[model samples]
Target chain A: MRAMVYRGPYKVRVEEKDIPAIEHPNDAIIRVTRAAICGSDLHLYHGMMPDTRVGTTFGHEFIGVVEKVGGSVHSLSPGDRVMVPFNVYCGSCYFCARGLYSNCHNVNPNATAVGGIYGYSHTTGGYDGGQAEYVRVPFADVGPSLIPDWLDDEDALLMTDALATGYFGAQLGDIVEGDTVVVFGAGPVGLFAAKSAWLMGAGRVIVIDQLEYRLEKARTFAHAETFNYNEYDDIVVEMKKTTDYLGADVVIDAVGAEADGNFLQHVTAAKLKLQGGSPIALNWAIDAVRKGGNVSVVGAYGPIFSAVKFGDAVNKGLTLRMNQCPVKRQWPRLLEHIRNGHLKPNDIVTHRIPLEHIAEGYHMFSAKLDNCIKPLIVPNAR
Target chain B: MPSTPYVSNKPKNTETREELRARIPGWGADLDPADRPSYPKERLDPSATGAHWDFPERQAGAEGREHSIEHEIVPPVFGTSVPLKGFSGAIRRHAYASYSEGRAAHWLLLILGDRVDAWESHLRSLASLRPDNPVTETGVLSERRRHGIASRFGVKRSDINHQWIDPLIVGAPWVAAGGAAVVVVRKLVRRR
Candidate 1:
């Protein structure tokens, strides 16, 4: 089977490797159809995560057909088309019972910290991801949702992560009707959050980003006001000025570890590997929102201390909420939204390439070439 | 053309598993090796408490026991007192070898377990063994909770093999759960 193997920082090549087999009773082997290179995968590509051993494959967002199921997996059968979430969870655990499936207790041995994530790294449980011809999905009954017949393959693929995470970010913001929402970052999640905010009855939405292409995407796709932080001398002041000098009602940080803006903070945190991530967008969200407003963080960051302005957040009485978006939880509504034609998740997809050319795909996405917003990999390309 | 059968010389030993093991450095002591030890079934089973043919008395081969490290997974196979919290299945598997050979009348029991760091820490504890903290003390706890510290976290005095010694409080995540170990057990129970 051909799979993407991580050689080192900034090096990925599709290589012939053994198709993963079922390691546990609840496991399922799936023949991948479509996979996507995520913004988070870039963190691992750039050597941001720890314990990321070489020879490990890096891919999490994928949709596939069930090729085999372990003895205990009664919910799925061979040839069942499924979209596997990035999370690996056992449905019977304490956290899973409470709808906190991302922090499942019976999946990753390193569960004391982060939950099991496919293909992320050793930190998220060393499960192989779906960037290959075949992938092993643990807790097969729990995380993989069968794709709806009406849903496009690309859209279903996005729901595995980007779309669901963006929806989850909006869901976290708790936007009330007619509220003004400010979102930091014009990336995929940010765009989705901005769009989802309108669905949640936000009177106005503003997206901030340095990249004109993504900001353009935010304006066209999200239908929200846009701002380039680079153009503004002070982005927070601009945000305040736009919203009657009271700041926006809700703020979302879609950018995580490698957020650009503060030179020292970025250098010390992301470049130097000092803190978990730069926390730039988080701080920006804090400053850009009205006091006592909600802040939603959906950024992918390592588990380490960041030099965040917690004092300011405290002083402003912010209701800050963040987690690895329990991907499956947001799927039902997202499925309806997709079916109703409200969201074409694939509209954000800018490039499609075969799995063999994934290293080049990673390079193109990382470089942000050809105004790429998202790139989908076709693993079963004839 | 017929191919010759490929046979290369790699040292073949006639010594018994125990005899060959004793020749290894730092053997015949109460130290347990870092990975799983290969022992015949009859020697280590708690139900078969009688000493094997190697030992003359019932408790004579007690210290020679090998402990296999098994993960006390969540949706746990055995109901244990340890709080099952985060990711629990994906773990590093290791095969350990035991070092201690001499049989003692009393066996000391030590308990230890943490979620992510338990496996590595257990090996570190095994590696850190010396005359001060003998192998008799840290025989490597298992999930069976047969008075082992890894599963239940807390070890009772009666769970010890012999007399209950003073408990040592280590500053680990396990310590917060109030899991203390009985480092010395001086009384021997006969199964014969």
Candidate 2:
């Protein structure tokens, strides 16, 4: 099997590797049919995340056919098609019992800090990712949901991370019937988040981004008003003006550590490595919302410190809820949305590259070249 | 000559902060205008999120079936007290008399004259509760130390995490003890 091996920052190559065998009875070996390049994968590619060891695979968003099943994996069998969640969790853990699958206590020795994530850096438990011909799916009974016959393979691939996480971002906003929602960043997650916000009963949704292409996608796909932050004197003021000067009821930071707004802050946080990834997006979110508003952060940030305005958030009496989306938990509702024709997760996929060209895929996605919103990796593509 | 501290003409730290606010547009942007923060910048170290496997992959059974015990989860250790409590009274005394070197094997039969589970759980509880060495006092690991050595090397825990469990398990002559305990515990729970 050929797997995407992470050599270093800006270096990934699909190399021949042993087909991952089922390590446990509850595990299954999935022959990956499709995988997506996630916005967060850029964090690993840019070396923003810690403990990103060399030689590990670097994909999490994948859908596949179960090629082999462990004896204990009764929920699935060989030849069944399944889409594994990005998380690697034990369904029996305390966190899993409570539907907090992303914070599963049993999967990672680092579970005390972060949950186990497939193909993410070591900070997320060094489970190899799915951007390969074959990948091991852990806790097969819990994490991998069988792809419904109606769901497209690309849609199933997106659901593994981006779609579910975006929907979860809106769900975290706790949106009221007529709440106004603001989402920062027009990336794929933001696009899905804005689209999902409407499903959550948001009366008005606005997406803010510096990029024109994504903002256009926000309009056409998300069906929401869009703003380019660079065009305005202050994006927050514009948000306040749009919302009757009270600010939005909920603001989601879809852009994580690599947001580009403040020059010095970006340099110190992203370049100098003095702090964690840039806090600019999160800070902008805190600044843009109403005093008692909710801020939903689905953006991926490093474990290191980021200089944030904590005092202002405290003073404003904010309700902030964030986590890596427990993707399986959101699947039922997301499937319903897909069935009802409210969402088309696959529509956002702009490019499909063979597994062999993952290096080029990573480069194009990272450099924001070719207007690549979401790029899918076809593992068996010739 | 070196006694005098160098107080250059540059402004104090407070002035530097003020100058930054005047220079940077979004410096104090979102904060309450009426309530100005006295400090401009402060170094913050969030709790270090430890996400590393300090050890290599577990060398497993030829076919990879007999993997580490990190995946074998015990029932919820919280909300449920240990089933047997008096496990400590004999296990501790005999452990000191025999395996006091903290040898990872045979203390149970020598001391409490029982399986490794009771002795292991008891010793673990003791280790967690205020050992003279301050480092041994954390209760969080009580939940962790419960993982089967195999699971630590195999299932729930990643193989890459520091495999102190491997040495700890291999060093012991009683490798099968924990696995036996699992069967016993599962059967006991099923009967209940």
State the C-alpha lDDT per candidate: 0.64, 0.66
Model 2, A331: alpha-carbon shift in Å?
A: 1.0
Candidate DockQ scores, in order: 0.01, 0.01
For model 2 the interface RMSD, in Å, equals 22.7
Interface RMSD of 1: 30.4
Positional deviation of residue B48's Cα in model 1 after best superposition, in angstroms: 44
* Candidate 1 vs. true structure, TM-score: 0.68
Candidate 1 DockQ, CA atoms: 0.01
Q: What would the TM-scores of all predictions be?
A: 0.68, 0.68
lDDT of 2 by residue, A161-190 (tens): 898888788777877655678999889899
Q: What's the C-alpha lDDT at position A244 in model 2?
A: 59
Name the TM-score of candidate 2: 0.68
